[model samples]
Target: MNNTDHTTATVEPAIRLESVTKQYVGAETVTALADVDLPVYGGEFLAIVGPSGSGKSTMLNLLGLLDGPTEGVVRLGGRDVTDLSETELTDARREYIGFVFQDFHLLPTLTAVENVTLPTAFTDGQYADRAVDLLGRVGLGDRLDHTPDELSGGQKQRVAIARALINRPEILLADEPTGNLDRETGVTILEEVRRICERGVAVVAVTHDELVTEYADRTVRLVDGRLGEGDDGFAT
Candidate 1:
């Protein structure tokens, strides 16, 4: 390879896996991800799609740092996550990762603004204030004081998204973020996701919904713990 090729190869992937394999042992052993190699760049919207038990959610969880692989290396921005201690992994998650989920997991007791600001408690000065600003930016300024029950489903989702963005992470990992919403509401949430990607946050969402791919910059299909054929696509 030429020097340019070497340089390109050295460039960091925002999220990456090399020969990654995941397995669970119960009464029997099951492989959830097998010899997977994937890369996500710094500013892309990538969707992971597949049927049930196809490893889509497992991939998301691993990328989100919610779980570690049984074998192989996982890297974030060139850092080797697999080699990190538990405390280091926890700190890395706080500093570099954001997560959004389908169920709109907002605390019913807290207001929207509080929900967004909650994570900031573990962070430093001005964190709470920044969370409030994020909520406002997500168009929740008027609903800041509303609890989950006081808001519409979509509004609650908006709050959940704002909460995810509170730390301004480099990558946003969303697991079936629209699964609980109606079609229109789902689109609205996805549009917000697209907006986040526009701002240069890499977004990876796991979903079974084909309509969601329309918003993604790239689509990857997983099947039986492997990357399926012809699963790669660029924006048309």
Candidate 2:
């Protein structure tokens, strides 16, 4: 390898919110998030914690590209994607990001491997072997043929974790990832997620569950639409 290769390459955040804000202009104006600047790097696990109605969901939506910021920009791999069209945004989402929802939204009719490959539906490739491998990564190799109802809550979540990794996303957005499970199961799931982070995927999780902080490399909190790094917006 050329020595210049290491010297010339630049590292950028996997996804970031640069001076972002979101407001709901209804009968009343509601500022969901205000001027927040956050950068999540690969191989890092970041936990965003706050009470309900404190803009956690709003942040997740922005990070996941499900919605855009009313101000500032959302950047992916250092590229500004703040103003992408719906089609472009959809493609961006599919190519760059993965999500783990608390509900484990697996299709009841699909087996674990089938559900793991769902995100690749519009692509022209089949990923059966990769899906099987991801299931094995999450300790669900034996459950590949099981449907959502056939698996326990934790097993379903393990499947969800595997599904999120199938696309090899640079960033993984987990919304309340452990909210639906008991303590022991939740710990197992968190371990799987941390392992994913260690493999160089950026993991951003929004949660009210304090247990997430134990696995996170860093923690931040949102309060009244503002972001900070302390107990309630000071630590960042």
For each candidate, what is the lDDT?
0.83, 0.89
Q: Residue by residue across 1-236, what tens digits does model 2's lDDT show?
A: 01123666766788889999999899999999999999998899999987788899999999999999989999988889999999999989888899999999999999999999998876655688899999998888899999999999999999998888888898899999999999999999999999999988999999878888889999999888888784532333
Error of 2 at 6 (Å): 5.2
Best by lDDT: 2
Q: How accurate is candidate 1 locally (lDDT)?
A: 0.83
Error of 2 at 226 (Å): 0.6
Provide the lDDT at 171 for model 1.
88
In the order shown, the candidates' Cα RMSDs to the true structure are: 4.0, 3.0
**How high is the lDDT of residue 129 in model 2?**
88
lDDT of residue 234 for candidate 1: 24
- TM-score of each candidate structure, all chains considered together: 0.91, 0.93
Report the Cα lDDT for residue 70, model 1: 95
Pairs clashing in candidate 2? 229-234, 229-235, 229-236, 230-234, 230-235
